[model samples]
Target: MKRFIAVLVFAVVAFSCSKEKGNMVVKGQIKGLKKGTLYLQKMNDTLLVSVDSVKLFGDDKFLLSDNVESPVMYYLTFDGNTQEKKIMFFGEPGEITINDNVEEFGWKPGISGSKNQEVMDKFNEINQQFKLKRLDFIAKDMEARAKKDTAAMDSLEKEYKKMVRRRFLFTTNFAVANPDTEAAPYIALSELFDANLYLLDTINNSLTSRVKSSDYGMRLQKFIDDVKAQEKK
Candidate 1:
């Protein structure tokens, strides 16, 4: 009888322990950011951590998963900000926490106490490719226009827009898919259009808004003044 009771007690503890460990899913959208890469990191002790990143899709949704331990805290970082969420293994699965505000960087799910380093390097290489293509288009267009070659100029313009659209799609997709992150990558792609006149008409409105809006325009003017003032002083 003593041995049987001990067996039953051990079985109960084993079952409870098994139930306490399970998978957790995190989902959220990045607002006001059109393109960028979002990173999910698992904290390791002593300034070490394992990191993973997801590309943001056009719809601005992101998902991350981990096998959680009870009372564990993980961080959701986007752009340059980080938010904490305390994971409770006792609750139902599929719980969600959304980090929406980009300024204060508030968290929807509370009861979190924490804290990663490192950025995604793959996206950087792709961005370099985009810059090279953009420059090539600009130089070709300039030479064609200078020679009075209307047909070649027109062709270059069309090709430039097409290249821009492809970059937009890549950035938009990554931004939407990882809404919990920033749109820095997508914003960088916007700079490519500075040399391509043909892009102003064909590119997405969001990309154009960044270049032409009073928000950016006023800031740009202020920047120029600040630079000039510094030069004099």
Candidate 2:
């Protein structure tokens, strides 16, 4: 019968539409979202690519997943755009939960269930203190410059350079401390890329065997090699 053939086609389509059970499962809620698409994205060779997406009609909750071959940074993006709002986190193989409001989506979204993310949080907490000090130095330097105080300006300039070196040393030490986590190499790649070659070498050498094989770890290694090659030329 025609009715039986239609039912068979419907069943086939339904089966094909079933969601995949990827290694990394991301599930969470955007408090004010009612009708929009959410994309789970990551960088693939310098291009941001969306691996999975979901459309919510009336609910604030959503679930998206991707097959993570190695731990890498993943971006929870809104409406397929990363220019304005996106939550970045160190993604690994496991169930991770994210909760945030659309108004302050990228400002301070809560992320959990990834060890690398926790390591990143701790590093950022201390790094923020250094940032605050840098801002204070900038204010004082501007004030000294406005008054045309040459002696004071020179003193502040030397102090600012020292503070910058201190911050770089702190980052190098922190990355060396978390050698077993992917955050270690990620920190080196993001925060200390322009640091002294020796500092980069120290962190790269200190990475754990597993972490050295991670996505960022490999990238860090490549970056160091490229820098060395350029130095020779």
Candidate 3:
């Protein structure tokens, strides 16, 4: 009786441990994906490593589970014969759901679960406007070059610079307004890095203390220091 009770207690403890292991759950369905593999990848130091994977055969559904220490960027990569597609998302320690059609894989899919992801989606929506403007500039530049119109080419170059400055200002504003989020520092470094050093310093100084101590925040500070050192030389 004593041995049996001990075995039962051990079983209960083992089940509890298993339940507490996984902190993040990712479940999704890919329409028209008959047979393929799905990889859930995250950056481990400098390398993008696959933390979880699922092999699907004649099924369009998959589930992946892992533990995340904080809000971080993650990738959902589809391995197929003809082409490979990857979707990036800011993942947190919770359940996230994604739904996408394999036929239209390159387009943004529906993702839900993390607040950081929602912030990223909002940023992308605004960033798309700038992207369209850049495309228009590219088209006009090409046309001017094809016609050998030096005056038009010069005008277009000025307009292109104005557009770049406008985009940089918008990014800086967004970072300043959303200082508590990880996306703020990320955009300051990734999107507005080429802007004026004073503008970068402004964004960095505006971040909250908690955000300033974050991983991306520290990186951004270091980047600014490096750029200043270069300028001094």
Candidate 4:
């Protein structure tokens, strides 16, 4: 009876460890998050459902996990509906580490351990430049409108359209270059959804079969098909 009890205890301990870690292990620290509830979330048919949560009374470190069916985006946020104060990262079936300060939680987080997130980080770095230029153009346009300068307003509008086209082309090329990663489809679906069909098709055709079958990949394919069907009508 003693030997049987020892075996049962070991089994129970293993089961508990597996249950806590799950498939995707999300463990990290928010430097100033002293006492608050953190929730790990993902989209399930448009709903942001929490997979796991932890309440930290003293320590800043936390652990949350979920069984990822396939690699997708995830949100790490605090309790209640504070959507703005959260970190969004690409979640996969491995351990991911996220460390940031509570002051600038999502502004510039240091996320590692996922190849997809690395790709996203690189893309975002370049995209930020385009976003800044867009802001400058918006401010100039507003100034022109206030002064009733028709010629300046026309020039600004034309320049803005050119910048938009450049961004679209750049995004399409980036997606094509990273064809094997699931991020490619996601980039096309998110960044170039409203772009010309030709550009969207180019990115879609360049995706690898494995990535083409991913959640975002399948969604991109469906989105393209739906658009084609609409045009046919």
lDDT of 1 by residue, 63-173 (tens): 655564422324556554434422211111345445464443443323211110011233444767888999999899889989999999988889988988887656544
* Model 3 CA lDDT for position 154: 98
Q: Pick out the ten consecutive residues of candidate 2 with the lowest summed lDDT.
A: 77-86
C-alpha lDDT of candidate 2 relative to the true structure: 0.91
Model 3: lDDT of residue 124: 89
Summarize candidate 3's per-residue lDDT along 1-233 as a digit string, tens digits: 99999999999999856644369999989899878888889888789898888788999998887887656788888776333567788777889999998877747799999777888888889999999999998999999999999999999999999989899888888888888887788888879877899889999999888878877888889999999999999
Off by over 4 Å in 1: 1-120, 183-233
**What's the distance in Å from true for residue 80, model 2?**
7.7
Among all windows of 10 consecutive residues in model 3, the one with the lowest summed lDDT is 78-87
Question: Model 2: runs farther than 4 Å from truth?
Answer: 1-5, 8-18, 80-82
lDDT by residue for model 4 (1-233), tens: 99999999999998867755678898889998899898999999889998888898989999888987778999998865367888989999889999988888888999998888999998999999999999999999999999999999999999999999999999999989999888888889899989999999999999999998999999999999999999999
RMSD of each: 16.7, 2.1, 4.7, 3.6
lDDT scores in order: 0.48, 0.91, 0.85, 0.91
Pairs clashing within candidate 2 = none
lDDT at position 36, candidate 3: 83
Which candidate tops lDDT?
A: 2
The clash numbers for all candidates, in the given order, read 16, 0, 0, 0
